[model samples]
Target: MTYLLEYSDYGSAGLLIPAGLVLIHLCALLSAFHSLQHVRTSQAAVAWVVGLVTLPYLALPLYWVFARNRFEGYREAIRDIGKEHDQSVTSIRRELFSEPCNQPRTFQSPLAQVATVMGTPVSQGNKYRLLIDGIAFFDTMLWQIQSAKRYVYASFYIIRDDQIGKRFADALIERANAGVTVRLLYDEVGCIRLSNRYLRRLTEAGVDVHSFNTRQGWVNRFQVNFRNHRKMIVVDGRVSIVGGLNVGDEYLGAIPSMSPWRDTSVQIEGSLTRKVQAVFAGDYYWAARADLPEADWQRKTDCGTTDSNDPSLQEEPSGLGAVCTTGPADERPRTSMMFSAAIGAAKERLWISTPYLVPDDAMIVALAMAKARGVDVRLLIPSVADLWAVYLAGFYYERKLAEIGVPVFRFTNGMLHQKCVLVDDSLTLIGSTNFDNRSLHLNFEVMVAIEDRAFICEVEKMLDRDFANAKRSNGSNRPLRPWFARAGTALARLFSPVL
Candidate 1:
């Protein structure tokens, strides 16, 4: 009778523990169901479902933290804000349409199609100078900021609270104190380590500062995957700078170990500057929920024109460019479509350079098709990556492309971080968007597509130099690894949907 009572008590206690576990699992299943409806990719949805149903204890929290697909409330907030500024957006659109590009007939159709997809038209009479490294980029950027007479709108993905960052902050503060309209936007996740003191200094100096908060509302409290990866600076509605370089001492090669940081940026003046400003305006409104002053749309008649004797106008009037801003807020996946379009349009040659090369199925197919059609395809990626998982994941895709006859080059010299695409000798795509899943579907990105033969040649020459320094590989060059190392890479590839 005693043994029977003891056994019954143990059984009841065990039941209580499993009953609680069952309830927790049931809740996890409910969350997994929610994920199935919102996850961006089918593969990701299935993965979450299986993991949640089988290993709910571990997968549930990860799903909540990192598996958010769409940016909840951001689109709605953008819509509401757009409705409030419908007049301004419409007016800007009208102005963009009024100033048509004088591009060659062969380039006009494709450019127009891209413009339609991006909702920003190609503008002509724009002067462009390619800044090869951080030194040139920051020097020119600081000069532009100092010369700001009306307003300065600046945005960056990573703004370190270091020496270089303080210089940038001081310049902006100086302009702000001088009564120029100055607004600064930084990504909260990218600047996660930024000190409060740094931002406080800017705010105290009368600079309008805001973070691109990915998790801003109740619905988005756990959604932290989306990021604003764009780096742009627009000064006085006349000069605009955009590219891969962020504000940091490392970017300037101040750190002896990470010296010789390879990056690219373009400085633009003329009609295209206004379009860049318009891009800034949208982001500003999204971050601050306040409307920026209407931009001055008056075109500089002598915009890209410079006297032959004048060295300052050396980069004048060389190309026509359009700004493409894309994010999850769009009803359609415009960035993916844009990449496909550029790839499909290439007939002669296609060259690409990006730090990350974990492309999606669509991109892989596009590249394969391009090769099938007899187009020369070349890809440049970092030989030594800063992110270990991303580096390993890149090898998986690199092997796939190499098996298909596409030559992949691993940059030998420092870390190559520039994002650029060259199609034939006409189209150049340069900006923050990388050839990866995260950039294509999740992050908010910007790219400037320029159609100009002269500029394209310069970019080609620059890339040729990069290719010369890089080691060409077709997977055979990759060193043999142990089973565990290979397995790690395969696992990283599996998570490419989120990476």
Candidate 2:
């Protein structure tokens, strides 16, 4: 009423001021209603509603950037691509699965064999092992890229324009020049600084390169909240390398601050590699809107392993592995479900390593439940701080988990950038997912769940070494941070749902 009186007492400009305020308030109310409908969790929805209703002036812009719970324009179509001789390519993005991808096979447009990442068929004789560090990961990845025969599909979150990036770009260019079909996908926000020269060289060499267009234009640039954070490279649809190492010199310990980068990637060779390529095909369709040149998807069940009764050779667990991909487009929060299900299935021990550990209430409860079941649950995070807000929020979570008797080990050897989870003695997960709301609820992410005892032993040995070098903090006897840092944590946690 006071605002109305002020507007009425003044001239036309004052009247417009009140109208603008009303418009802003109306937009906030609408966004609040959207939050109620779209936000995955009740806790996140209520937080947005309270802030939006109370502080529309400050909250509206932030809401525009971060509060969109779904990636609106992403598509799941697997086009029936032509052969390698096709001269041109065209693509169109569509929202095919308007709900949770429960019936993923129904998405088979004209390519029925092109599988979704929901649940790949388990097969035998697939050999999967870990690449322990950046050196091993890159050495194998680059060699495969250089030796591509039919096609190469590479997707990553970040591709820096440095020595590592040049070596990667040169490999793709060289392969393209040699008549190998090459497709490259990088996150738009992650490679926002990627120069035109770098991309131009690839295009000129006849390589199909596209950014995962999470953002449309500079006018709405902050819509970078959604990202395609998948790191995968498939050569001839036979070999796939999936994990955390990005195309950057820092990943190789070139930077003094982040020396000795610690990460892990898995290379699977056999029919299962086709599933990883399918994930790339779906993402490529969304970004490039064209069909990928067809490659061999023939199922071979007995290739990578020999049928032998010797004790040394008979210890394999049939190489059971399944792949799952998740993102904002799905109606249900699949990433959270994926993580919770893995946590629930751990009977003996569960070891998780992530650069970030900002879990939600449900995740806290999941950890508590795991501890109650006597599962040896441990979390490994980076001792160093990359993003202050996320790093600080981790302390708050560490304290909360400590209350439930779970301990966190901080890696001191280098930055712990691996998103890996080893469960008991048979299952392991590796890919480009962080344990935060953004990665679990918002980003387009991928992880291959391997359930082979042989592969699990490999992952266990790697994590054993990682844990051996880490510093353990129970968070019960001592403060994780000083009073000022603790105060910062309170503020940091306020943004965890969006972080």
Candidate 3:
């Protein structure tokens, strides 16, 4: 009777607000149920449920964008064209494994589990050079782009329209005009500021360029957060550069705010380069929806004169390595598992450097457990934060790990952007994977795992120099974060699932 009386008093026109509220709550209930069933982490599930149940209006849109753990569109697209990709992947694996991985007498490859997860094989006879800081950022990479004989392929997360970008554009335009096939794939979200004039200049020169649009077609309209963060370039499917440095003035340490911009990338060649090329092909296909017919799969990379007399150009044939490409499209959490495996495999010392350090609980436990086993585990994060939320959250994790005897160092020499890992004397990895939830779960990432003693030493010495410039902190003497930063830590935890 009261409901009827109120409806009559308000008339049909006033029912809109109440009707909308009922529908919103109903939708919230449905989303809450979905959260309970689909969310992988129990804590995240509970948080989502509580938020959706109490505040549906605000939480609904966020849930729609961030709650999805799987990249359904990427998987669906893969299913549409997976046959060719799978066959190629299988063929590559057989070719890689035909040459035995030269394992040490006692040490087994710790990356075996990672290889299984990525469905790729570790191959021998590969050569790699660790490119530290600005040494190889443009000097070597640009030279290779200029030296392209057949084709040039470049993919970056972010490309500025500044001086370095123009130089890079000039190289590709020159190559394309010379009848050398040139293609570029850049992340749309990362390169949102990239002007169309820059792209037009390349296209006018016959360069094929496309953005890796996160939201493509109807199936992917809701996936706004997934990003292609892989930074790699392959020339003629022979030589490749894969790692943390993207094409920008900041990457070259020219930007005053981000100067001395500490970063690392590697120029690798040999059979392993093919795997890197294939990974780019997959992303390029996703972006352009076409086969890269020009990619030379049959030709093996000759690398740098392997016989060069010049000291800077002389690089030895590396032993064994594999390229692990991972993303939200994967069935399992491959990036997190890969990092965990590396942590678990460290028998002597484990050192890692990344800009952000907000990892999940499971990864935290893995790091602490490694320390318990007497492994000299150390973490290097930036003293100057590039992303404030991620940096503040690192303080929380740093204290947590320190309580369990894992010390973290804050790199004081400008900003530390290198994503590197050193495991024992023969194992090391470099690429664009950060030790954070974003890289572990949300973003598309690629890492090169090398089991070459010579290359590993190069990485170790580089990190040693970084440690020398960083400040170490353990819970014992480290000061607590600011009271306001507690809010940032909470914010980090709340968004880490989707961030």
The weakest ten consecutive residues by lDDT in model 1 span 96-105
**Evaluation by TM-score, superior candidate among 1 and 2:** 1
- Evaluated at residue 287, the lDDT of candidate 2 is 82
Candidate 1 residue lDDT tens string, 105-135: 2434445556655556666677788888889
Reference-based lDDT, each prediction? 0.82, 0.78, 0.81
Q: What are the per-residue Cα lDDT tens digits for candidate 2 across 118-169?
A: 3334434578878988889989999999988989999998998899899999
Best prediction by TM-score = 3
lDDT accuracy of residue 304 in candidate 2: 23
RMSD of 2: 7.1
In model 3, the worst 10-residue window by lDDT is: 96-105
Stretches of model 1 off by over 4 angstroms after superposition: 1-23, 91-110, 297-318, 475-484
Prediction 1 TM-score vs. true = 0.88
Per-prediction TM-score: 0.88, 0.85, 0.89
